[model samples]
Target: MSVVITQVFNGFSLGSILLFVAIGLAVTFGLMGVINMAHGELIMVGAYMTYVVQQIFAKYAPQSMGYYFFIAIPVAFFVSALLGWGLEKILIRHLYHRPLDSLLATWGVSLILQQIARTIFGAPNVAVLPPEWLDGGVRIAGVVFPYKRLFILVFVILSIFALYIYLTKTPAGRRIRAVTLNRDMASCLGISTRKVDAYAFAIGSGFAGLAGCALTLLGPIGPTIGTYYIVDAFMVVILGGVGKLIGTVLGAFGIGLVSTLMEYSTSATMAKVMMFALIIAFLQWKPSGLVSVKTRSLD
Candidate 1:
Protein backbone atom coordinates (compact mmCIF):
# COMPACT_ATOMS: atom_id res chain seq x y z
CA MET A 1 0.00 0.00 0.00
CA SER A 2 2.78 2.40 0.90
CA VAL A 3 4.54 1.54 -2.34
CA VAL A 4 1.38 2.27 -4.27
CA ILE A 5 1.05 5.66 -2.65
CA THR A 6 4.66 6.47 -3.32
CA GLN A 7 4.28 5.52 -6.97
CA VAL A 8 1.15 7.64 -7.19
CA PHE A 9 3.10 10.66 -6.00
CA ASN A 10 5.85 9.91 -8.47
CA GLY A 11 3.29 9.74 -11.25
CA PHE A 12 1.88 13.10 -10.27
CA SER A 13 5.34 14.62 -10.21
CA LEU A 14 6.19 13.27 -13.63
CA GLY A 15 2.81 14.32 -14.94
CA SER A 16 3.32 17.82 -13.65
CA ILE A 17 6.52 18.21 -15.64
CA LEU A 18 4.77 16.84 -18.71
CA LEU A 19 1.93 19.26 -18.11
CA PHE A 20 4.33 22.18 -18.06
CA VAL A 21 5.98 21.16 -21.33
CA ALA A 22 2.73 20.18 -23.03
CA ILE A 23 0.78 23.27 -22.00
CA GLY A 24 3.20 25.43 -23.94
CA LEU A 25 2.98 23.18 -27.00
CA ALA A 26 -0.78 23.19 -26.68
CA VAL A 27 -0.89 26.97 -26.72
CA THR A 28 1.50 27.31 -29.65
CA PHE A 29 -0.19 24.64 -31.73
CA GLY A 30 -3.74 25.71 -30.97
CA LEU A 31 -3.05 29.38 -31.45
CA MET A 32 -0.55 29.50 -34.30
CA GLY A 33 -0.84 26.06 -35.87
CA VAL A 34 2.94 25.80 -35.74
CA ILE A 35 4.21 22.38 -34.79
CA ASN A 36 7.29 23.48 -32.94
CA MET A 37 9.69 20.57 -32.95
CA ALA A 38 12.12 22.81 -31.15
CA HIS A 39 9.90 22.99 -28.09
CA GLY A 40 11.95 20.27 -26.40
CA GLU A 41 15.12 22.20 -27.19
CA LEU A 42 13.70 25.07 -25.16
CA ILE A 43 13.53 22.65 -22.23
CA MET A 44 17.13 21.64 -22.85
CA VAL A 45 18.11 25.30 -22.78
CA GLY A 46 16.47 25.68 -19.35
CA ALA A 47 18.29 22.67 -17.96
CA TYR A 48 21.56 24.03 -19.23
CA MET A 49 20.79 27.38 -17.65
CA THR A 50 20.23 25.62 -14.34
CA TYR A 51 23.56 23.88 -14.73
CA VAL A 52 25.24 27.20 -15.46
CA VAL A 53 23.66 28.77 -12.39
CA GLN A 54 24.84 25.85 -10.32
CA GLN A 55 28.37 26.38 -11.55
CA ILE A 56 28.18 30.08 -10.77
CA PHE A 57 26.86 29.41 -7.29
CA ALA A 58 29.52 26.81 -6.64
CA LYS A 59 32.25 29.26 -7.56
CA TYR A 60 31.00 32.44 -5.93
CA ALA A 61 28.42 31.33 -3.34
CA PRO A 62 29.26 27.81 -2.24
CA GLN A 63 27.05 28.12 0.80
CA SER A 64 23.98 29.19 -1.16
CA MET A 65 22.89 25.90 -2.71
CA GLY A 66 19.40 26.24 -1.32
CA TYR A 67 18.86 29.58 -3.02
CA TYR A 68 20.42 28.54 -6.30
CA PHE A 69 17.28 26.85 -7.61
CA PHE A 70 15.15 29.84 -6.69
CA ILE A 71 17.51 32.15 -8.57
CA ALA A 72 17.79 29.78 -11.55
CA ILE A 73 14.01 29.55 -11.95
CA PRO A 74 13.63 33.13 -13.14
CA VAL A 75 16.80 32.99 -15.14
CA ALA A 76 15.59 29.91 -16.91
CA PHE A 77 12.31 31.66 -17.64
CA PHE A 78 13.99 34.69 -19.10
CA VAL A 79 16.51 32.74 -21.12
CA SER A 80 14.01 30.37 -22.66
CA ALA A 81 11.50 33.16 -23.26
CA LEU A 82 14.10 35.24 -25.07
CA LEU A 83 15.10 32.32 -27.25
CA GLY A 84 11.47 31.53 -28.02
CA TRP A 85 10.70 35.15 -28.81
CA GLY A 86 13.67 35.37 -31.10
CA LEU A 87 12.65 32.20 -32.86
CA GLU A 88 9.17 33.59 -33.31
CA LYS A 89 10.55 36.85 -34.74
CA ILE A 90 12.86 35.01 -37.08
CA LEU A 91 11.78 31.57 -38.30
CA ILE A 92 8.30 30.81 -36.91
CA ARG A 93 6.74 34.10 -38.00
CA HIS A 94 7.17 33.23 -41.66
CA LEU A 95 5.72 29.72 -41.41
CA TYR A 96 2.47 30.61 -39.69
CA HIS A 97 0.05 28.83 -42.04
CA ARG A 98 2.45 26.24 -43.39
CA PRO A 99 2.49 23.74 -40.55
CA LEU A 100 4.54 21.12 -42.38
CA ASP A 101 7.21 23.62 -43.28
CA SER A 102 7.21 24.95 -39.74
CA LEU A 103 7.64 21.44 -38.42
CA LEU A 104 10.64 20.84 -40.62
CA ALA A 105 12.19 24.17 -39.80
CA THR A 106 11.66 23.72 -36.09
CA TRP A 107 13.10 20.22 -36.26
CA GLY A 108 16.17 21.66 -37.92
CA VAL A 109 16.34 24.25 -35.18
CA SER A 110 16.08 21.52 -32.58
CA LEU A 111 19.05 19.75 -34.08
CA ILE A 112 21.04 22.95 -34.11
CA LEU A 113 20.24 23.67 -30.49
CA GLN A 114 21.16 20.16 -29.42
CA GLN A 115 24.49 20.29 -31.28
CA ILE A 116 25.27 23.69 -29.81
CA ALA A 117 24.56 22.43 -26.33
CA ARG A 118 26.80 19.47 -26.90
CA THR A 119 29.61 21.65 -28.13
CA ILE A 120 29.41 23.88 -25.08
CA PHE A 121 28.28 21.60 -22.26
CA GLY A 122 29.88 18.41 -23.60
CA ALA A 123 28.10 15.09 -23.97
CA PRO A 124 28.52 14.16 -20.32
CA ASN A 125 25.53 14.44 -17.97
CA VAL A 126 25.80 16.87 -15.07
CA ALA A 127 24.28 16.21 -11.68
CA VAL A 128 21.93 18.78 -10.11
CA LEU A 129 21.79 18.25 -6.38
CA PRO A 130 18.52 19.23 -4.73
CA PRO A 131 18.50 21.47 -1.69
CA GLU A 132 18.62 19.79 1.71
CA TRP A 133 15.05 20.74 2.47
CA LEU A 134 13.81 19.01 -0.68
CA ASP A 135 16.16 16.03 -0.71
CA GLY A 136 14.36 13.84 1.80
CA GLY A 137 11.04 12.04 2.01
CA VAL A 138 7.99 12.98 4.03
CA ARG A 139 5.78 10.48 5.82
CA ILE A 140 2.04 10.70 5.16
CA ALA A 141 -0.41 8.12 6.45
CA GLY A 142 2.36 5.50 6.62
CA VAL A 143 3.39 6.38 3.08
CA VAL A 144 6.71 8.04 2.31
CA PHE A 145 6.46 10.75 -0.31
CA PRO A 146 9.59 12.41 -1.60
CA TYR A 147 9.62 16.13 -0.94
CA LYS A 148 10.96 16.78 -4.40
CA ARG A 149 7.98 15.05 -5.99
CA LEU A 150 5.50 16.78 -3.70
CA PHE A 151 6.99 20.18 -4.42
CA ILE A 152 6.82 19.59 -8.17
CA LEU A 153 3.16 18.59 -7.99
CA VAL A 154 2.27 21.65 -5.93
CA PHE A 155 4.29 23.99 -8.11
CA VAL A 156 2.73 22.68 -11.32
CA ILE A 157 -0.79 23.06 -9.94
CA LEU A 158 -0.11 26.63 -8.90
CA SER A 159 1.44 27.45 -12.27
CA ILE A 160 -1.58 26.08 -14.10
CA PHE A 161 -3.94 28.06 -11.86
CA ALA A 162 -2.00 31.23 -12.52
CA LEU A 163 -2.12 30.60 -16.26
CA TYR A 164 -5.86 29.89 -16.09
CA ILE A 165 -6.53 33.16 -14.33
CA TYR A 166 -4.32 35.04 -16.75
CA LEU A 167 -6.13 33.57 -19.73
CA THR A 168 -9.65 34.01 -18.40
CA LYS A 169 -9.48 37.22 -16.37
CA THR A 170 -6.84 39.33 -18.07
CA PRO A 171 -7.44 41.47 -21.14
CA ALA A 172 -4.25 40.35 -22.80
CA GLY A 173 -5.17 36.74 -22.27
CA ARG A 174 -8.63 37.32 -23.75
CA ARG A 175 -7.04 38.76 -26.83
CA ILE A 176 -4.80 35.72 -27.10
CA ARG A 177 -7.81 33.42 -26.94
CA ALA A 178 -9.57 35.52 -29.50
CA VAL A 179 -6.58 35.27 -31.80
CA THR A 180 -6.52 31.53 -31.36
CA LEU A 181 -10.16 31.35 -32.39
CA ASN A 182 -9.81 33.54 -35.44
CA ARG A 183 -6.58 35.35 -36.26
CA ASP A 184 -8.01 37.54 -39.02
CA MET A 185 -10.98 38.65 -36.91
CA ALA A 186 -8.78 39.33 -33.90
CA SER A 187 -6.46 41.38 -36.09
CA CYS A 188 -9.42 43.26 -37.51
CA LEU A 189 -10.46 44.21 -33.97
CA GLY A 190 -7.09 45.97 -33.55
CA ILE A 191 -5.52 43.16 -31.61
CA SER A 192 -1.91 42.62 -32.54
CA THR A 193 -1.96 38.94 -33.41
CA ARG A 194 1.80 38.88 -33.93
CA LYS A 195 2.41 40.32 -30.51
CA VAL A 196 0.00 37.84 -28.96
CA ASP A 197 1.85 34.99 -30.67
CA ALA A 198 5.14 36.25 -29.32
CA TYR A 199 3.73 36.56 -25.80
CA ALA A 200 2.15 33.13 -25.95
CA PHE A 201 5.37 31.52 -27.20
CA ALA A 202 7.38 33.27 -24.53
CA ILE A 203 5.09 32.07 -21.77
CA GLY A 204 4.99 28.54 -23.12
CA SER A 205 8.74 28.34 -23.53
CA GLY A 206 9.20 29.82 -20.08
CA PHE A 207 7.17 26.98 -18.62
CA ALA A 208 9.38 24.49 -20.43
CA GLY A 209 12.32 26.19 -18.78
CA LEU A 210 10.69 25.72 -15.42
CA ALA A 211 10.16 22.07 -16.19
CA GLY A 212 13.86 21.67 -16.89
CA CYS A 213 14.66 23.18 -13.52
CA ALA A 214 12.18 20.85 -11.86
CA LEU A 215 13.69 17.86 -13.68
CA THR A 216 17.09 18.60 -12.20
CA LEU A 217 15.57 17.88 -8.81
CA LEU A 218 15.09 14.29 -9.99
CA GLY A 219 18.34 13.50 -11.82
CA PRO A 220 21.26 14.67 -13.98
CA ILE A 221 21.13 17.17 -16.86
CA GLY A 222 22.23 16.35 -20.39
CA PRO A 223 22.16 17.95 -23.83
CA THR A 224 19.51 15.54 -25.11
CA ILE A 225 17.44 15.41 -21.95
CA GLY A 226 14.59 17.19 -23.66
CA THR A 227 14.18 14.30 -26.05
CA TYR A 228 12.98 12.12 -23.18
CA TYR A 229 10.04 14.40 -22.44
CA ILE A 230 9.18 15.54 -25.94
CA VAL A 231 7.04 12.56 -26.93
CA ASP A 232 5.31 12.44 -23.57
CA ALA A 233 4.64 16.16 -23.73
CA PHE A 234 3.06 15.78 -27.14
CA MET A 235 0.99 12.89 -25.84
CA VAL A 236 -0.40 15.01 -23.04
CA VAL A 237 -1.20 17.92 -25.33
CA ILE A 238 -2.84 15.72 -27.95
CA LEU A 239 -4.76 13.68 -25.39
CA GLY A 240 -5.94 16.81 -23.65
CA GLY A 241 -6.84 18.55 -26.89
CA VAL A 242 -5.13 21.53 -28.46
CA GLY A 243 -5.87 25.01 -27.05
CA LYS A 244 -7.58 23.76 -23.86
CA LEU A 245 -5.65 24.36 -20.65
CA ILE A 246 -8.05 22.26 -18.60
CA GLY A 247 -7.68 19.44 -21.08
CA THR A 248 -3.90 19.47 -20.67
CA VAL A 249 -4.24 19.09 -16.91
CA LEU A 250 -6.72 16.27 -17.20
CA GLY A 251 -4.64 14.47 -19.81
CA ALA A 252 -1.50 14.77 -17.71
CA PHE A 253 -3.12 13.23 -14.67
CA GLY A 254 -4.84 10.51 -16.65
CA ILE A 255 -1.70 9.50 -18.53
CA GLY A 256 0.42 9.77 -15.41
CA LEU A 257 -1.81 7.52 -13.36
CA VAL A 258 -2.06 4.90 -16.07
CA SER A 259 1.67 4.90 -16.74
CA THR A 260 2.47 4.63 -13.05
CA LEU A 261 0.21 1.61 -12.62
CA MET A 262 1.80 -0.03 -15.62
CA GLU A 263 5.33 0.62 -14.35
CA TYR A 264 4.47 -1.29 -11.20
CA SER A 265 3.15 -4.24 -13.15
CA THR A 266 5.93 -4.44 -15.74
CA SER A 267 9.25 -3.04 -16.94
CA ALA A 268 9.50 0.65 -17.81
CA THR A 269 9.87 -0.10 -21.54
CA MET A 270 6.82 -2.34 -21.50
CA ALA A 271 4.94 0.26 -19.52
CA LYS A 272 5.69 2.89 -22.15
CA VAL A 273 4.52 0.61 -24.90
CA MET A 274 1.28 -0.04 -23.08
CA MET A 275 0.76 3.65 -22.44
CA PHE A 276 1.30 4.55 -26.12
CA ALA A 277 -1.11 1.83 -27.17
CA LEU A 278 -3.69 3.22 -24.81
CA ILE A 279 -3.16 6.72 -26.15
CA ILE A 280 -3.66 5.44 -29.67
CA ALA A 281 -6.88 3.76 -28.61
CA PHE A 282 -8.08 6.89 -26.87
CA LEU A 283 -7.44 8.97 -29.98
CA GLN A 284 -9.42 6.58 -32.13
CA TRP A 285 -12.39 7.09 -29.84
CA LYS A 286 -12.11 10.84 -30.15
CA PRO A 287 -10.40 11.68 -33.39
CA SER A 288 -10.37 15.40 -32.62
CA GLY A 289 -8.82 14.80 -29.17
CA LEU A 290 -10.40 14.84 -25.71
CA VAL A 291 -11.39 18.49 -26.03
CA SER A 292 -12.56 20.02 -29.30
CA VAL A 293 -11.86 23.66 -30.05
CA LYS A 294 -14.48 25.58 -31.98
CA THR A 295 -12.69 27.47 -34.75
CA ARG A 296 -14.55 30.24 -36.57
CA SER A 297 -13.87 31.17 -40.17
CA LEU A 298 -13.29 34.87 -40.85
CA ASP A 299 -14.54 34.52 -44.39
Candidate 2:
Protein backbone atom coordinates (compact mmCIF):
# COMPACT_ATOMS: atom_id res chain seq x y z
CA MET A 1 0.00 0.00 0.00
CA SER A 2 2.78 2.40 0.97
CA VAL A 3 4.68 1.53 -2.19
CA VAL A 4 1.67 2.20 -4.37
CA ILE A 5 1.04 5.55 -2.74
CA THR A 6 4.67 6.56 -3.14
CA GLN A 7 4.70 5.57 -6.76
CA VAL A 8 1.53 7.53 -7.40
CA PHE A 9 3.09 10.60 -5.91
CA ASN A 10 6.24 10.06 -7.91
CA GLY A 11 4.21 9.69 -11.12
CA PHE A 12 2.31 12.92 -10.57
CA SER A 13 5.53 14.71 -9.75
CA LEU A 14 7.18 13.46 -12.91
CA GLY A 15 4.10 14.35 -14.95
CA SER A 16 4.13 17.89 -13.66
CA ILE A 17 7.75 18.23 -14.71
CA LEU A 18 7.01 16.86 -18.18
CA LEU A 19 3.98 19.13 -18.48
CA PHE A 20 6.09 22.17 -17.73
CA VAL A 21 8.59 21.18 -20.37
CA ALA A 22 5.88 20.60 -23.00
CA ILE A 23 3.25 23.22 -22.19
CA GLY A 24 5.03 25.86 -24.20
CA LEU A 25 5.53 23.49 -27.09
CA ALA A 26 1.79 23.05 -27.23
CA VAL A 27 1.58 26.69 -28.26
CA THR A 28 4.62 27.03 -30.48
CA PHE A 29 4.43 23.73 -32.27
CA GLY A 30 0.83 22.75 -31.77
CA LEU A 31 -0.99 26.01 -32.29
CA MET A 32 1.46 28.08 -34.28
CA GLY A 33 2.76 25.12 -36.28
CA VAL A 34 6.38 26.06 -35.94
CA ILE A 35 8.94 23.45 -35.04
CA ASN A 36 11.02 25.17 -32.39
CA MET A 37 13.95 22.94 -31.59
CA ALA A 38 15.33 25.83 -29.54
CA HIS A 39 12.50 25.52 -27.04
CA GLY A 40 14.77 23.71 -24.60
CA GLU A 41 17.32 26.54 -24.75
CA LEU A 42 14.57 28.90 -23.69
CA ILE A 43 14.18 26.68 -20.64
CA MET A 44 17.91 26.86 -20.07
CA VAL A 45 17.62 30.62 -20.26
CA GLY A 46 15.00 30.58 -17.51
CA ALA A 47 17.07 28.29 -15.29
CA TYR A 48 20.09 30.54 -15.72
CA MET A 49 17.90 33.51 -14.93
CA THR A 50 16.92 31.83 -11.67
CA TYR A 51 20.57 31.15 -10.90
CA VAL A 52 21.45 34.78 -11.59
CA VAL A 53 18.67 36.07 -9.38
CA GLN A 54 19.82 33.78 -6.59
CA GLN A 55 23.33 35.14 -6.89
CA ILE A 56 22.07 38.69 -6.84
CA PHE A 57 19.98 38.08 -3.77
CA ALA A 58 22.81 36.32 -2.04
CA LYS A 59 25.27 39.10 -2.74
CA TYR A 60 23.15 42.20 -2.28
CA ALA A 61 20.41 41.06 0.04
CA PRO A 62 21.66 38.13 2.03
CA GLN A 63 19.20 38.94 4.77
CA SER A 64 16.28 38.43 2.36
CA MET A 65 17.38 35.38 0.43
CA GLY A 66 14.06 33.74 1.05
CA TYR A 67 12.36 36.32 -1.14
CA TYR A 68 14.68 35.74 -4.05
CA PHE A 69 12.48 33.04 -5.57
CA PHE A 70 9.54 35.39 -5.83
CA ILE A 71 11.63 37.74 -7.88
CA ALA A 72 13.31 35.01 -9.93
CA ILE A 73 10.07 33.64 -11.35
CA PRO A 74 9.06 36.81 -13.20
CA VAL A 75 12.60 37.60 -14.20
CA ALA A 76 12.97 34.24 -15.83
CA PHE A 77 9.66 34.60 -17.66
CA PHE A 78 10.25 38.07 -19.05
CA VAL A 79 13.83 37.47 -20.08
CA SER A 80 12.95 34.33 -21.95
CA ALA A 81 9.88 35.97 -23.40
CA LEU A 82 11.96 38.86 -24.63
CA LEU A 83 14.35 36.45 -26.26
CA GLY A 84 11.49 34.53 -27.84
CA TRP A 85 9.96 37.70 -29.18
CA GLY A 86 13.26 38.64 -30.71
CA LEU A 87 13.74 35.24 -32.29
CA GLU A 88 10.30 35.34 -33.78
CA LYS A 89 10.81 38.81 -35.17
CA ILE A 90 14.22 38.06 -36.64
CA LEU A 91 13.95 34.49 -37.84
CA ILE A 92 10.88 32.44 -37.01
CA ARG A 93 8.38 34.83 -38.50
CA HIS A 94 9.75 34.14 -41.97
CA LEU A 95 9.64 30.37 -41.63
CA TYR A 96 6.07 29.96 -40.42
CA HIS A 97 4.98 28.38 -43.71
CA ARG A 98 7.98 26.07 -43.88
CA PRO A 99 8.17 23.62 -41.03
CA LEU A 100 11.35 21.91 -42.12
CA ASP A 101 13.11 25.24 -42.48
CA SER A 102 11.86 26.39 -39.10
CA LEU A 103 13.05 23.17 -37.55
CA LEU A 104 16.53 23.50 -39.05
CA ALA A 105 16.77 27.17 -38.17
CA THR A 106 15.69 26.64 -34.58
CA TRP A 107 18.09 23.76 -34.30
CA GLY A 108 20.96 26.02 -35.32
CA VAL A 109 19.79 28.71 -32.95
CA SER A 110 19.64 26.18 -30.12
CA LEU A 111 23.25 25.22 -30.79
CA ILE A 112 24.27 28.87 -30.73
CA LEU A 113 22.50 29.48 -27.45
CA GLN A 114 24.05 26.37 -25.93
CA GLN A 115 27.50 27.51 -27.00
CA ILE A 116 26.88 30.93 -25.52
CA ALA A 117 25.79 29.39 -22.25
CA ARG A 118 28.94 27.30 -22.19
CA THR A 119 31.01 30.39 -22.84
CA ILE A 120 29.43 32.37 -20.04
CA PHE A 121 28.57 29.79 -17.37
CA GLY A 122 31.28 27.29 -18.37
CA ALA A 123 30.66 23.57 -18.81
CA PRO A 124 29.99 22.86 -15.13
CA ASN A 125 26.56 22.26 -13.62
CA VAL A 126 25.48 24.72 -10.92
CA ALA A 127 23.00 24.19 -8.12
CA VAL A 128 20.30 26.60 -7.02
CA LEU A 129 19.60 26.72 -3.29
CA PRO A 130 15.97 25.96 -2.52
CA PRO A 131 14.19 28.42 -0.32
CA GLU A 132 14.24 27.75 3.38
CA TRP A 133 10.47 27.40 3.37
CA LEU A 134 10.65 24.40 1.03
CA ASP A 135 13.25 22.46 2.95
CA GLY A 136 11.18 19.62 4.34
CA GLY A 137 8.45 17.05 3.66
CA VAL A 138 5.11 16.20 5.19
CA ARG A 139 4.06 12.65 6.05
CA ILE A 140 0.60 11.70 4.83
CA ALA A 141 -0.84 8.21 4.94
CA GLY A 142 2.63 6.86 5.63
CA VAL A 143 4.01 8.58 2.56
CA VAL A 144 6.32 11.55 2.70
CA PHE A 145 5.35 14.39 0.38
CA PRO A 146 8.19 16.78 -0.19
CA TYR A 147 7.23 20.43 -0.12
CA LYS A 148 9.24 21.15 -3.23
CA ARG A 149 7.38 18.57 -5.32
CA LEU A 150 4.04 19.63 -3.90
CA PHE A 151 4.88 23.23 -4.66
CA ILE A 152 5.65 22.29 -8.26
CA LEU A 153 2.35 20.48 -8.67
CA VAL A 154 0.44 23.42 -7.23
CA PHE A 155 2.36 25.90 -9.32
CA VAL A 156 1.68 23.98 -12.53
CA ILE A 157 -2.00 23.71 -11.73
CA LEU A 158 -2.33 27.41 -11.09
CA SER A 159 -0.38 28.32 -14.20
CA ILE A 160 -2.54 26.09 -16.35
CA PHE A 161 -5.70 27.57 -14.86
CA ALA A 162 -4.48 31.08 -15.45
CA LEU A 163 -3.56 30.20 -19.00
CA TYR A 164 -6.99 28.70 -19.61
CA ILE A 165 -8.69 31.86 -18.41
CA TYR A 166 -6.47 33.97 -20.59
CA LEU A 167 -7.16 31.93 -23.68
CA THR A 168 -10.88 31.65 -23.14
CA LYS A 169 -11.87 35.03 -21.72
CA THR A 170 -9.44 37.62 -22.99
CA PRO A 171 -9.76 39.44 -26.30
CA ALA A 172 -6.09 38.94 -27.22
CA GLY A 173 -6.38 35.27 -26.54
CA ARG A 174 -9.53 35.01 -28.63
CA ARG A 175 -7.69 36.60 -31.49
CA ILE A 176 -4.92 34.08 -31.09
CA ARG A 177 -7.38 31.25 -31.17
CA ALA A 178 -8.99 32.76 -34.24
CA VAL A 179 -5.68 32.90 -36.03
CA THR A 180 -4.85 29.41 -34.96
CA LEU A 181 -8.08 27.99 -36.34
CA ASN A 182 -8.05 29.75 -39.65
CA ARG A 183 -5.29 32.21 -40.39
CA ASP A 184 -6.89 33.53 -43.58
CA MET A 185 -10.26 34.07 -41.98
CA ALA A 186 -8.72 35.68 -38.93
CA SER A 187 -6.74 38.02 -41.11
CA CYS A 188 -9.86 38.84 -43.10
CA LEU A 189 -11.58 39.64 -39.85
CA GLY A 190 -9.05 42.47 -39.29
CA ILE A 191 -6.94 40.64 -36.73
CA SER A 192 -3.25 41.38 -36.83
CA THR A 193 -1.97 37.86 -37.29
CA ARG A 194 1.66 38.95 -37.09
CA LYS A 195 1.22 40.55 -33.71
CA VAL A 196 -0.83 37.59 -32.57
CA ASP A 197 1.89 35.18 -33.63
CA ALA A 198 4.58 37.12 -31.79
CA TYR A 199 2.54 37.42 -28.62
CA ALA A 200 1.50 33.77 -28.66
CA PHE A 201 5.06 32.62 -29.22
CA ALA A 202 6.28 34.90 -26.46
CA ILE A 203 3.69 33.57 -24.09
CA GLY A 204 4.69 30.01 -24.95
CA SER A 205 8.37 30.77 -24.33
CA GLY A 206 7.47 32.47 -21.06
CA PHE A 207 5.83 29.27 -19.88
CA ALA A 208 9.03 27.44 -20.69
CA GLY A 209 10.77 29.95 -18.43
CA LEU A 210 8.42 29.10 -15.61
CA ALA A 211 9.17 25.43 -16.16
CA GLY A 212 12.87 26.22 -15.80
CA CYS A 213 12.26 28.01 -12.51
CA ALA A 214 10.41 24.95 -11.23
CA LEU A 215 13.25 22.66 -12.34
CA THR A 216 15.73 24.35 -10.00
CA LEU A 217 14.15 22.59 -7.05
CA LEU A 218 14.84 19.18 -8.51
CA GLY A 219 18.57 19.28 -9.23
CA PRO A 220 21.56 21.24 -10.44
CA ILE A 221 21.40 23.08 -13.80
CA GLY A 222 23.82 23.53 -16.64
CA PRO A 223 23.97 24.75 -20.24
CA THR A 224 22.78 21.32 -21.26
CA ILE A 225 20.03 21.12 -18.67
CA GLY A 226 17.42 21.86 -21.29
CA THR A 227 18.62 18.91 -23.35
CA TYR A 228 17.70 16.51 -20.57
CA TYR A 229 13.99 17.24 -20.83
CA ILE A 230 13.61 18.14 -24.52
CA VAL A 231 12.73 14.68 -25.75
CA ASP A 232 10.22 14.13 -23.00
CA ALA A 233 8.66 17.48 -23.66
CA PHE A 234 8.27 16.71 -27.35
CA MET A 235 6.83 13.34 -26.55
CA VAL A 236 4.19 14.84 -24.29
CA VAL A 237 3.20 17.48 -26.81
CA ILE A 238 2.98 14.96 -29.61
CA LEU A 239 1.11 12.39 -27.59
CA GLY A 240 -1.37 14.92 -26.27
CA GLY A 241 -2.10 16.44 -29.66
CA VAL A 242 -1.27 19.98 -30.68
CA GLY A 243 -3.18 22.99 -29.34
CA LYS A 244 -5.26 20.88 -26.99
CA LEU A 245 -4.80 21.74 -23.32
CA ILE A 246 -6.80 18.91 -21.81
CA GLY A 247 -5.06 16.44 -24.05
CA THR A 248 -1.66 17.74 -22.98
CA VAL A 249 -2.58 17.37 -19.35
CA LEU A 250 -3.88 13.85 -19.74
CA GLY A 251 -0.96 12.83 -21.91
CA ALA A 252 1.61 14.18 -19.46
CA PHE A 253 0.17 12.44 -16.43
CA GLY A 254 -0.45 9.26 -18.37
CA ILE A 255 3.15 9.07 -19.53
CA GLY A 256 4.38 10.00 -16.08
CA LEU A 257 2.40 7.28 -14.32
CA VAL A 258 3.20 4.62 -16.88
CA SER A 259 6.90 5.48 -16.92
CA THR A 260 7.08 5.34 -13.13
CA LEU A 261 5.33 1.96 -12.86
CA MET A 262 7.37 0.50 -15.69
CA GLU A 263 10.63 1.70 -14.18
CA TYR A 264 9.66 0.01 -10.94
CA SER A 265 9.11 -3.29 -12.73
CA THR A 266 11.91 -3.00 -15.30
CA SER A 267 15.13 -1.16 -16.03
CA ALA A 268 14.90 2.53 -16.93
CA THR A 269 16.08 1.94 -20.50
CA MET A 270 13.62 -0.85 -21.03
CA ALA A 271 10.85 1.21 -19.58
CA LYS A 272 11.59 4.03 -22.06
CA VAL A 273 11.75 1.54 -24.90
CA MET A 274 8.44 0.09 -23.87
CA MET A 275 6.88 3.54 -23.57
CA PHE A 276 8.15 4.51 -27.02
CA ALA A 277 6.88 1.34 -28.56
CA LEU A 278 3.47 1.86 -27.02
CA ILE A 279 3.29 5.45 -28.21
CA ILE A 280 4.30 4.41 -31.69
CA ALA A 281 1.67 1.75 -31.79
CA PHE A 282 -0.94 4.14 -30.47
CA LEU A 283 0.03 6.75 -33.04
CA GLN A 284 -0.18 4.20 -35.81
CA TRP A 285 -3.80 3.61 -34.94
CA LYS A 286 -4.63 7.25 -34.19
CA PRO A 287 -2.35 9.36 -36.34
CA SER A 288 -3.97 12.57 -35.19
CA GLY A 289 -3.08 11.90 -31.52
CA LEU A 290 -5.25 11.60 -28.44
CA VAL A 291 -7.12 14.80 -29.21
CA SER A 292 -7.72 16.04 -32.71
CA VAL A 293 -8.10 19.73 -33.40
CA LYS A 294 -11.22 20.67 -35.35
CA THR A 295 -10.82 23.18 -38.14
CA ARG A 296 -12.56 23.97 -41.43
CA SER A 297 -10.59 23.78 -44.65
CA LEU A 298 -11.33 24.17 -48.34
CA ASP A 299 -11.86 20.87 -50.11
Identify the leading candidate in terms of lDDT.
2
Clashing pairs in 2: none
Model 2 lDDT tens row, 246-274: 88888899999999999999999999999
Q: Report the C-alpha lDDT of model 1 over 32-116, residue by residue, as the tens digit.
A: 5678899898988988899899889989999887799899989988899899999998999899889899989999999999999
Candidate 1 residue runs with Cα over 4 Å from true position: 294-299
True-structure lDDT of candidate 2 = 0.92
Give the CA lDDT, 0 to 100, for residue 44 in model 1. Answer: 88
Q: TM-scores, in order shown?
A: 0.95, 0.97
